[model samples]
Target: MYSNTSELAEDKLLLLYLLDKIKLPISNNKVTEIILENNFINYFTLQQYLTELANANFINYIEQEGKHRIIVSNKGLKVLSLFRNRISEVKIKAIDCYLKKQMESIKKEIAISADYTIEGNNYIVNLKAVENNSILIDLKLNVASNKQAKDLCAKWKKNSSKLYNELFKVLINN
Candidate 1:
């Protein structure tokens, strides 16, 4: 879990690139070709990005015969989204003093298996890990809302997910 970041990054690039492409689970060469044709990023740098995404347990784009493919499983979307929101919020630091105790309390009540500390430019947080088999149910008290986070989680599924996911699925199914 701690080392899947690189591969997860790669997956993101592949997914993002192939999102509206000929669908995923295509040929291995197709993935490489897509990477090359994009040319927005070079080989080594791109590889590193892929590696990062993979390490984070995102998804992997593999090539088989002559097509590219994708594998989507989990939802780190909530955690990742939270990271995005709190990323620039300096006030998050104020919760530090109570964070440790809160973490302990949460661990007792929930199935958080492991945790990681992410240090941001303005804030830091200890992300309590949820079980690999469980869906993350986040319940917060209060905060000014953008609703994007709520919307993101709702879009986790194809039918219930957002237009991007539905469109992505159509392309993949073909």
Candidate 2:
């Protein structure tokens, strides 16, 4: 049985290890999904540790194009080198397998973009679908409410593939 404090430490280390493996900055949402899959930490605690890591200089966050990406710092690398064994080999393998399976999907999710900005008296929601670092769809729609904008963003992220296929079908059929 692991103590609560020890579990938190493990969670932090696991996160660092994951970032190291990917060797690229990933969004907090991606990290949250991976960690939640393993049931290592709850969502709120995961958010707390992400903040703690950034504050401790163990990790840094880069905000580009209105999205945040998390990268491990040199200090974090050194710490992982020192204490990575605190995480079991089993957990390590699990992370490795998870990333191998989900990395592409995660990248796709990152590539699909959605955001809303207020313009004069309306909310303009911008949605995009990208593939191979190329823009496949760039759409802007004016919506009536903040809630509608938020919902559209969520729906776009969730159903982007379906949307893309349907769009192509419509364009080709016409």
TM value for model 2: 0.67
Model 1, range 103-166, lDDT digits (tens) per residue? Answer: 4443232332221222332222122223333544322222123353344333332222234345
- Model 2, residue 118: C-alpha shift (Å): 5.1
Residue 16: error of model 1 in Å? 3.1
Best by TM-score: 2
Determine which window of 10 residues in candidate 1 has minimal summed lDDT. 121-130
Clashes per model (N, Cα, C within 3 A): 38, 0
Q: Over 4 Å off in model 2, which ranges?
A: 1-8, 118-125, 128-174
lDDT of 1: 0.39
